[model samples]
Target: MELGYSDSVRENVEILDVVSASEEVGILDDVINQGESEVVHLKVGMKFDTVDEIYELYRKYAQQKGFPIKKRSSKKDNGVLRYICFACCREGKHKTDSETPLQPEPTSKFGCKAKLSARLDLDEKWRISVLVLDHNHETSPSKSRFWRCNKKISNHVKKKLLLNDKAGIRMHKHYYTLVVEAGGYENVTFEEKDCRNLVEKERHLKLGEGDAMAIQSYFSKMQKHNTGFFFNIDLDKEGRLKNIFWADGRCREAYKEFGEVITFDTTYLTNKYDMPFAPFVGVNHHGQSTLFGC
Candidate 1:
C-alpha cells in the first residue's frame, strides 16, 4: 500500500507561520506553491466560529491566489465540509468574462489532488489537522475580484444603489460609496464594471424595451383603472399613436370654460421614452394660469 507521506517528508512541511488566520492560509498557500508540495500538516491555534468559516476563508484565499478550490461536506444538515482541496487548473480559458465555471464546487473528481481536513480541538476551536496539498500541475495568479462569488452585493445594497441612482447620484459615485461602506476594496469582491452593470440591469428591467407595444399596454392599463378618464388617441397613416389627448373629468370641465384662449408649451419637461409631454394652460377669472389639457 502507498502511504500518504513519510515522516521525513512530513518534517519539512511545518509551514504555518503567519499573524492572522487569513495570513496563515496565505503562507500555507505560498509554501504549497514554492515547495510544490500539498501535504503540509498545519497546527493552527486560531479560533473560528464554525467549520464553514475556515473553509470559506481558505477557499477565498486560494481563489485570490489564482488556485482553483474544491470542497465536500460530510453530509447534509450537519453539512459543513469534512475536507477542502485545491484543484489542478485545466489548460483552458481562465478569463472570468468567458462562459465557464470559475471556482470548483464540492465534488469527488480526480482532477483536484491537493486536500485539507479540519477538526475541532479540545479548546472548542477549529484546526487544520490533515492537509495533502501537492498539486500535479502548474498554476497562475488571478485578480481576486474577477472570480470571487462570495462578495456579492445583497438585495439591500442594490435597493439603496437604485435609490441613489434615481436621486441623481452618478453611477461611478455610487459604486465608490458602496466600496467605502464595505470597509475597503478587499471586502468588495466584484469590480466597478460589475456594479455599473447591476444599475443598468435594474434600469432595463424597469423600462423594458420601450417599444410602441409597451406604451400601448401601459396606456390600456391606465384607461381601465380610471373612471373619470377621457383620452383621444390619434393614429397616423402608419397606424401609430401620433397624437394623444388625455384628461380627467375635472380637467375636461375646466377646459370647457378656459379652452378659448390657451397657451401651448412643448419645450419644458421631457420623458424618458423621448415622448413629448406638452400641456395647454389658460388664465382663470382668478387671474391665475390653470391647466386646460395635456
Candidate 2:
C-alpha cells in the first residue's frame, strides 16, 4: 500500500514552531511532548498520522528505556512508503577484524530481537503490526549520553565555538562556559574534546599550501624508497589536510617485535608550525627507548 501525509501532521509541525534551534542537528535530549497524555506506549494497533510521528514516538520510547534505536528497514510501493521497521541499535553482528587479530572486537551487538514494524493502512495512517520489546541485554537511562544518536553538535553551537576560537578564547574556557550555560556537563550533548577537534580543524585549514604539499611529497618519497613504509592522512570537509601519520620500514619491524606495549606522547610542539608533536615509543631488548612511529 502507498502512504500519504495527513493535513494534521503539517498543522502539528506549525504548532511546534517554538522548538529550540539545537533540535535541527539531530534527536535532542527532550524529544517527547511533555504532556502526560502524549506518553508513547507502543502496541500492535497503535497508529500515527505521519512516519516522522511514528519514528519520534519510537525514539522517545527507546530513550526512556535506556537504549538506542535505528531505522532497520523500509519498503516503498510506487515511490510511496508502505512499510517501515525500527529496532535496537544492537540488533545484528558486526564483522570481525581478521587481518588485525590483536584488535579488540566490538561489543555493541548482541543479536537483540527488540523491534517494531508498522504498515500503512487503507486510511493512510501508519499502524503497528509487530512489536517485540524484549531485550537480550540490560538498559539504563543514565548512560544515554554515550548513545551516538543522542550526541549532536548543533550549528548554533558550532558557530559559537568558531567565534570563540577567533576571539582567542581558550577551548577549555569556552567549553566550560557552554557547560555552565547548559547547567552542567551532563546537560551538554557533546564533550570538550569535540570542541577541541573543531578548533584543531580550523588551525589545520590555516596551514599554508607549501607546508602541506611539502609534507605529502616527503611521505611519497619515503614510500617509494621503502615498500614497507605506511602512512595515512586525514582531511577536513573542504579537502584540506587535517592531520597525518606515518611509519617507516624500520618502525614497522620494531613494532612486530615490541608491539605488545607501546607509548604515544604528544607533549611537545613542532618548532616551525607549532603543531603538536607525537611519537610512538617502545622498549627494546636492552631496555632502551625505540621509536615505533610518529
Candidate 3:
C-alpha cells in the first residue's frame, strides 16, 4: 500500500509496529523498521494504473452501502473528494437538503372539551333616575311656571336638597328667564315687575314692543328739529308740478320771491289722438318758456 502524509497512514504505521515488535525477540522490531522505510518507497513507486485499481475497489465497497464518492479536478493543494451520505444522498458539508420532508406533530397527553364563554353588562340606573325627576317636577305645586329660577340659586338649592335627600337631587332645574325692557317705561307695572326682574336676572335682555315704538318716536322728533321745508315743487311754463306732485321747493321759493309766474298749455294729444293728455309741465321767464317733461 502507498502511504501519504495523513492521520490514517500514521495510525497504520503504529499498528504495524505494535503487531510485529516483542520484548523477547528484537527481530520483529527490525522488521518494523524496515517496513517503515519500505512504506516511503511504496509511496514513490505508486503509478497512475495502481491508483485507478485501488479507486475501483473502493467504489465497489461504497456501492454496496449506497454511499457514492465522486472525484473532482485535482488542485495544487489537494484533490477534491465529494462524499455523499449513504442514507440521505445529500452531498457536500454533511448537511441535509432544504427540500427534506417535515416531521409529524405530537399528540396531547390529556384531552379536555369545555368551550370558552364571556358576556358584557351595562349600568341602566340613570334611566330610572330621569323618570323619577320628571314625575317629581310635574307633581310639585310650589314649582313656579311664570317665574324662572336663577342658575346660582338653583345650584345652591340642589346641593342643599342633595344633602337633605340625595334621591330627590337627581333632576336638574330646567327653567331660565328672558328679560325685556321698555325704553321710556323703566318702571314696569306692579303685577309684571317680578316676572320682568326674574327675566332680567336669568337670560339675555331685549327691547319690548313699547320700547321699540318709543325709540322710533324719539328719532322722528329729532328729524323734525332739523327739518327746514315740508314740501318740494318744480314748475315749468305751466302752473302745475314739473315732473310729479313733488318738486324742488327751493327753486319755487326763489321764483316766488322775484314775483315770477309761469303758464303753458297743460294738454297734448294722447297716442289715441282723441284724449287730451299732458305728461310734463314748463316754466316761462318774462316771455321765454322752458318745459320739463316726464
Candidate 4:
C-alpha cells in the first residue's frame, strides 16, 4: 500500500512539473506569431486530432483577425461525435422587446456571418469543411480581451486568487500584483472583474450552509399556510441572497383597505448581518398603523 501511494504521489508531481513547464513557456508566443499571415491562415480540409485542436487553431486565427469565436453547434451519430461549428461571437441579431427595461442591457450580436465548420472523418480525425472570414464590423486586437470568448481565468490564476483572498489581500492589490507578475495587462488573459467573480464564487462555495437557506425554508412554511402570500428573493451571480421581500394574505387585504398612503421604511438595524429591515406600513380604518409587507 505504501509503495503504491508513493508511486501515485510521484506520478502527480511529474504531472504538475509538466504543467508548470508548459505555463512557463506560455501561449502568448504562439498568439503573437499568429500576427503573421502564414501562421494564422485557416484553410478548408485542415486536419486535427480533437475538437479542441480545431478550436485552438481557429482561436489563434481570430486573435490575429481581431474577432472572438464561440462554439456554435455540434452533431453526434450513435453517441459518436461527428460535426462541429464555430462562429463569430457576434453572429446573431439582437431581439428587441416592445417594452424597454429600466436598465437596458448591451448586446454584441449584429448578424455577423463569420464561421468555421468542421466534420469528423473515418480516420477519427476532425477536418475543416467550411470557413468564412468575412465580418460585418470592425475588429480591434487591442480590445479583443474584453470579449467573453477571449477572456479566461486559468487554474494557476485561480490558485493565486484563492491564496491572496485567504491572506486577506485587497482585490485591487492582488490584481495589481498579478498584472506585475504577468509582465503587463496585455499578458493577463482575464480582467480584475473576472478574478473578483472567481473569488466570490469560491467564497460562496466555501460557505456550505448559509442563512439564505433557512430564510427560504421559513418562507416556504409561511407559503404553505397562506397560499396568497407572495415572496421574492433576489440572488447575486454567486447564488448569495441579496434581497428578500414577502407579503402575507392579511397584508394584502390590509393594503386593499388602507394602502391609500403606504410608507416604506428601512431605517431599522435589526439583524447581525447589518442588512436593513425594510417594511411597508399603512394606517387602518381604526387609525392604527398596520403592517403591509416586508
lDDT of each: 0.55, 0.76, 0.29, 0.77
Q: Provide the lowest-lDDT 10-residue window in model 2.
A: 27-36
Candidate 4 residue pairs in backbone clash: none
Model 3, CA-based lDDT: 0.29
Candidate 3 residue lDDT tens string, 1-294 = 874758855654443343333322432222121211121111211222233443443333333223323332222214422221111112223233446357434332111211111111132111111000011111221221111210112333223323422222112111110111111111111123443334434322233335444644664564476452233234344232233232234434544544344443556643421333343343555554443322
Q: Name the top TM-score candidate.
A: 4
Candidate 1 RMSD to the correct structure: 21.3
Error of 4 at 30 (Å): 14
lDDT of 1 by residue, 1-294 (tens): 976877745432321111122222232222122221243223344446687777666655555445655454342335643333333333223333444467545432345456556666556676666555555555444443455443356555566556666766666665654454456665565667776878876654133334556656766777788766667777555454467787776677788887779888777644443456788888888888888768
| 100-173: candidate 4 lDDT, tens digit per residue | 68766678888999999999999999999999999998898877667787777766667656775775667776
Preferred candidate (lDDT higher): 2 or 4? 4
Backbone clashes, each candidate: 4, 0, 8, 0
The count of backbone overlaps in candidate 1 is 4
Write the candidate numbers in order of decreasing TM-score: 4, 2, 1, 3
Candidate 1 residue runs with Cα over 4 Å from true position: 1-48, 70-74, 77-110, 119-129, 140-142, 154-160, 169-188, 200-294
> Weakest 10 consecutive residues, lDDT, candidate 3?
124-133
Can you tell me which runs of candidate 2 are displaced by over 4 Å?
1-40, 94-104, 197-294
Query: lDDT by residue for model 2 over 1-294, one digit each (tens)?
Result: 844658866544432332223344432323222232345588899988998988878877886788999999999999999999999998998778567778767678999999999999999999999999999999997776667666667766777677767756667766665664566776777778877877676665456557667878899998999999999888676656667889999999999998889898888977545677789999989899898999
